[model samples]
Target chain A: MKKHNYSAGPCILPQEVFEEASKSILNFNESGLSILEISHRSKDFVAVMEEARALVLELLNLEGKGYQALFLQGGASLEFLMVPYNLMKTNGKAAYLDTGTWASGAIKEAKAFGETVIVASSKDANYNYIPKDYSIPTDADYFHCTSNNTIFGTQMKSFPNTTIPVVCDMSSDIFSRSLDFSKFDLIYAGAQKNMGPAGTTLVVVKEEILGKTGRAIPNILNYEQHIAKESMYNTPAVFAVYTSLLTLKWLKKLGGISAIEKINEAKANLLYTEIDRNPLFKGTVLKEDRSAMNATFLLENQDHQELFDSMWKKAGISGINGHRSVGGYRASMYNALPLDSVQVLVDVMKELEKNS
Target chain B: MKKHNYSAGPCILPQEVFEEASKSILNFNESGLSILEISHRSKDFVAVMEEARALVLELLNLEGKGYQALFLQGGASLEFLMVPYNLMKTNGKAAYLDTGTWASGAIKEAKAFGETVIVASSKDANYNYIPKDYSIPTDADYFHCTSNNTIFGTQMKSFPNTTIPVVCDMSSDIFSRSLDFSKFDLIYAGAQKNMGPAGTTLVVVKEEILGKTGRAIPNILNYEQHIAKESMYNTPAVFAVYTSLLTLKWLKKLGGISAIEKINEAKANLLYTEIDRNPLFKGTVLKEDRSAMNATFLLENQDHQELFDSMWKKAGISGINGHRSVGGYRASMYNALPLDSVQVLVDVMKELEKNS
Candidate 1:
């Protein structure tokens, strides 16, 4: 049976990426060595690292724009701490937009460094909408925000114009849409979403924004050190980076973010249209702030839950169960999810309405 | 031709592990979903995380010893910074044994926390041997050392008896040998060595030793947070951990460390004996401190370099090139490296002498 995987980040990557990654595990690049067994410093793996870094910049259209792309480990959670360590000064504060769980998590880590100012938050409304009209403190070292809130199904359609270096955690929506990526000084994403698997985090940082923190930073957390080492400061996640490169190559072959954005929009629209039109369900977040990558919806009547669940399961649709915070379904339409899968989900929703 | 991979940390794993891991990437556990595309929170993956953690303690004989095993990212290098962050108090000092490159790296990170006392160092001899006669400071918060030095090809024969907590970076030789295991309060190994792949790190620490540091530690760097979350404080390297679990299962089927220890010792002895008997070759590190996992050797006569290099390449041997620190050959025989592979290398060395 064909499975439509929509379980948020670490969700779905291209089928071809999975096939090549699987084959590489047995014999990487025809080197007669399992990808898992080869050294990270090996010429073959080094090319993988270099190509992955270069491809990330190329896909984001940030090539030759003073940005260095690094595939580091520990996911975006580590980036939360590293951002403050490498960017925030000895006594300087950081302004953050508390959009959702991840944004607030970043703010929590930044508070450990120095003063952290929350410019705006939609938590009072349970993070169902993107909070606009936020004022960035000019004196702050940097402004931080989450590009997409996976759990709440909210996304920042437009970023705030700020002079201070902007750091965006694009963990869930990166590579899913087209944007002027150079506006952010640092853009980070845990590669589980639209990028690749779950082991590596992609960090794209402008060279000029680093080394001004004025505090002694640990070499592991310092962005400049990683750049100098060419992301081989220590042994990187070789297999994860290689798999990411495969996924990035797939994305590039599919014509980059601009091309995927159109397909993603179609998938999201197909699902959201059914949610708005069908009498059985309604969208979760405010329509304007709804995430194209993840569409959250709820049953108009709770009695239809069992019928809806079984119908999707019978239709070979998996991972639409909503997060604990929101008691509904979330259909994550990442770059790899086909429009046909979303249509199958729409049909399931219609069947549920008829049964109810 | 079958290749004998000795790439040193991210070296060889069981061939069966590679086959199974490769299959899982396409469809995990008959679930019809690529392991790469599944959520880390899924029941199947959660089981993987649980099994991998349990298997680490089980294989190490650390079960019921109040030791918590965590699969983390950023390799042992990140653990260098984290060890200091989570262990060393605000005003506390740490005692370290500077054995080789990785040990010195750990000591360097410890210096950022507070006073780092170097009890002993073999730097004068280019780390050719482990400095054994050293007194760990009684007042120090903890004692740190590297169990095996992959670069210099040396291993600590025995650990120092210390009342203070002991921390060891067993990255290159964790599962290849049998140890008291409880002697060290914390043991961290990057999974690329004898375990699985190069994405996740295995951190086994005694539960009692945590929360002693008085400094405000970031939650991301906090061991307590990871333990509380069952090593899923963030999105874990899902595929890496699952593959590691597969490797650990293979080790268990091979009768665990004590059984593999005999095989590892035999493989090491087979190659070391040939190195000793052959007139063309000489071992790099001191005889008494030579590592069983990684054997660093040099040509007694420089003229044999071309002949030996060509001979090994023709025999389907790879990754024997030594690190720049040691200018020669390094045959890393991790647990998964069969005795037959070492015998093939030994035959090549004998052939070189015959040709010479």
Candidate 2:
């Protein structure tokens, strides 16, 4: 059975990227050395890091700025703790937008460091809508927002325009859209979503935002330590970074973020439109706040949820089950997910509707 | 032209492992979904984690203890902070043996959280050998040591046997040999060197040692949190962990750690013998203290370093260059390095000796 992956993360990656990465894992660049064994500092692997960093900046259209790109270990979860540890100064407060599960996690980690003000929250509505009109405190060190909520399928389409440096946890939506680089002081994403695989976290931080946090940060958790040492403060996740670089190269060949955004938007629309039009199903997240990365919906007849799930699983649809916390269906439309895959999902939904 | 991969890490892996891992990356388990796209919470992945954890215990021959195995994100670098966060609460002090770079890192992080005592240090000898004769703090929380110095190529053959809990950062040499697990209260290794890849860190800790640390630790960094959640406290580095699971399974099939130890010993002897026999090169670390994982050496003729490097490079040998701080050569003989590869390196040295 041919299966189409719709998991929110550790999600689909480009075929070319996988092929290239697989070859290198066994014998990197025909060096008769496994990619896993190569030193992160070796000229070959250094080129891998350099190219990976460059591609990220190139993808973001922020190549020359003082922004330092790092391919560090620990997923976005570590970043949750690291963000505040590096930026939260003595008795400093960081504002966070509690959009979904990941946002809550970020908030939890920050609270351990210092006071964190929840600028906005969508939990009241079961995270079906994005809240607006939250006041950003001028005194807050920085504002943190999750660019896209993987579980809730809500995205911050427009970033809050504030003088306070904006930090984003774009674990899912990065590289699926275009953004003005000037707005974000720091941006980080776990590679499982739209990039390559798990194991590497991409951190893009403005060089100037660091050194303000007076707290003596642990070197491993300290972002400035990584920046100053160029992410080689220790041996990095070499294979993951190398695979990510290949993915980034693939994205560039596809005309960077702009071309992918069009594909992503089209895929999301195809799934969302079917959900809205189909009487048997209803979109979970508000129509205005529907995500371009993850389209979530619930079957009208809850009893048929299992049937729908079983039918889809039979149709080779994997990871369509909504997060257990949010019981429904979620079709993650990351960059590598082709429109045809989404169409297959839509076709499954329509056939079920027709049979019913 | 073939290349030999001698890069320290993200280093060499078995060809079979890469082949199997690559197949799954593109179409996992014939699901037609990329392994990267699967949810860690999914039954398939949960099985991977469970099996991987079980294999670790099985390989270590540590069974029927109140111990927990975790596949954690963040390298041992993160654990440098986490070790103290979870274990340093009793307030007397934790003893650490300062071996080399990573040991120093752990020491630096431990100092920030609580009182840390350096019981022994090899820095007096420029980290060329492991220290001997150290007073294990009688009332200390735990004793810590780096098992092998990847940069310096030294291994501690015997640990300081004490009543107080013993913690070790076995980042470089984990499966390289067999050991009595009862001696150490805690052991952790970053996966890059021996098991698989660089994204995941393996932690084995006795459950009782946790929660004694009075300091409130970040949930993700907390050992208790990972234990309670079975290393699923957060979204883990899924693919890396999965690959690690594959490697563990492969290790078990190859007769576990015991079989690999003999092979490691043999390979290390071959290279070290070459370094000892040849007048052109000399092993850097002391004879008895040399590491089975990383073998460090210095060229007698420094001027011919580049010539030797180019020759090695042409022989498909990669990552043979030593650390900039050390300025010589280091051929890391990690667990995955085949004896044949070592023989090839030895042959090249012999040819070089004859020609020189």
Candidate 3:
């Protein structure tokens, strides 16, 4: 059976990327040595690191924009700590927009360093919408926000025009849509969704924004040190970085973000259209704030939950069960999810409605 | 031709592990979804994480000792910061043994937290031998040391007896040899070496040693939080953890640490014996302190460098070039490296001598 993996993260990547990555594990680059066994500093692997970093900038169209792309380990959670350590100064303040769990988590870490302020929060309504009417304090070291909340199915369509350096956690929705990436001082995403697999995190930071914090930041957490070392300060996640390079290559060959954006929109629209139109189901979040990457929806009658679950499982759809916080279903339509899979999901929903 | 990979950390894993891991990337556990696409929360992957953690304890004989095994990211370098964050108390001090590059790196991070005392250092002699006659400060929060120095090819034969919590970075040596295992309160190793690949790190810490530090550790860096969360504090390196599990299963099937320890010793002895007897080459580090995992050696005549280098390359040998800091050849024979490969490398050394 063909499985349509809608996993939130460590999610679906391009099939070609998987094939290449799988082959590399056995014999990387025909070097007769598995990618798993090669040194991160080897010329071949170094090319992978360099290409991955370069392609990130190229895909984001941030070439020559004073941004350094680093493929680091520890996922975006570590970035939560690093962002404050590198950006927040001594006794400094940071403004964060609380949209969902990850945003609150980031704010939690920033509080350990200095004063952390929540500019606005949609938590009152279970984070069903992106809070747009938030003001960033100009004095705050940086205004941080989660571009897309994977759990709540909310995405900030337009970022606030901020003078204080802007940092965005694009963990789930990065590279799925076109954005003016240069507007943010730093953007980080775990490579599980839309990028690659779960071992690495992509950190694209503007060089000028660093080194101003004056905090005694640990070398491992310091962005400038990682940049100076060309992301080789320590042994990087070699397999993860190489697999990300393969993914980035897949994205580039598939016409970059602009091309994937249309496909993603189509996939999200197909499933969301079925949810909103079918009398048996409804969309979970506000229409405007609904994430194009993850579409959360619920059956209109809780009684039909068993039937709906069985139908999707029979249809070979996996990972559609919504996060426990938000009950129902979440169809994560990342870049690699084909429109055909979404159509299959929509067909299942229609079948459920007919059965009801 | 089969290649002999000795790339140092991020080095060799078993061929069976490579095959299994490669297959999982395409379709995990006969499930139509790639392991790369599966959720960490999924029963299958959760099992991987659980088994990997348990196997670490089981293999190390630490299971009944109240130690929690965690698979983390950012490598041992990040653990350099995390160890102090979770162990060193506010305004407390730490005692360290400066063995080689990684030990010094750990010491550097420890200094950022509080007072760090170096009880002994082998740096006066280019880290050719482990410093044994040193007193660890009883007042220190913990005593730290590197079990093996990958770059300098030195290994600690004995650890200092101390009442303070003993922490060891066994990145290059863990699982390759059998130790008392209970002597150290905390042991961390980057998975790239004998474990699996370059992405996740294995941290086995005694539960009693945590949370005593009055310092407010960020949740991500907090070992207790990770332990509480069952090592899935956030999205783990799903693929890395899974691959490490595959490697662990391989180790277990092959008789775990005690069994592999014998094989590792044999491989190390084969190469070291050749380096000793061959007139053309000499070992770099002191004989008493030579590492079984990584053997460093130099040509007796530097003029034969080009010839020896070519001979190894032609014989399908790779990653033997020594680190720049230590300008000699380093052959890292981690647990997965078979005795046959060591014989091949030894054969190359003899060939070089014949040519000389």
Estimate the TM-score of every prediction. Answer: 0.99, 0.95, 0.99
The TM-score, computed over Cα atoms with residue i paired to residue i, of candidate 2 is 0.95
Report the C-alpha displacement of residue B287, candidate 3, in angstroms: 1.0
| Interface CA root-mean-square deviation for model 2 | 2.0
Candidate 3 lDDT tens digits, A37-121: 8888888999999898999999999999999999998889999999999999999999999999999999999998899999999
- The residue-by-residue lDDT of candidate 2 on B1-356, one tens digit each, is 54556667766777678888878767778766666667888888888899888888888877778788999877898889888888887455888999898899899998976788998888888899888887987888889999899889899998877898999999888887999986788999988878888788999988878887667888888888888898888778787888888888888889988899999999998999899999999988989999988899998998767677777766777677788757698898887778887887888788777878
Candidate 1's residue-wise lDDT over B231-311, tens digit each?
Answer: 999999998899899989999999999999999899989999999999899999999999999999999999989999999
The model with the greatest DockQ is: 1
> What are the runs in model 3 whose C-alpha is more than 4 Å off?
none
| Clash count of each predicted structure | 1, 19, 0
The predicted structure with the larger lDDT, 1 or 3, is 1
Residue ranges of candidate 1 with Cα displaced over 4 Å: none
**Cα error of candidate 1 at position B56, Å:** 1.2
Off by over 4 Å in 2: B1-4, B90-92, B301-316, B351-356
lDDT of 1 by residue, A12-78 (tens): 8899999999999998898888889988888898999999999999999999999999999999999
**For all the models shown, what interface RMSD does each have?**
0.7, 2.0, 0.8
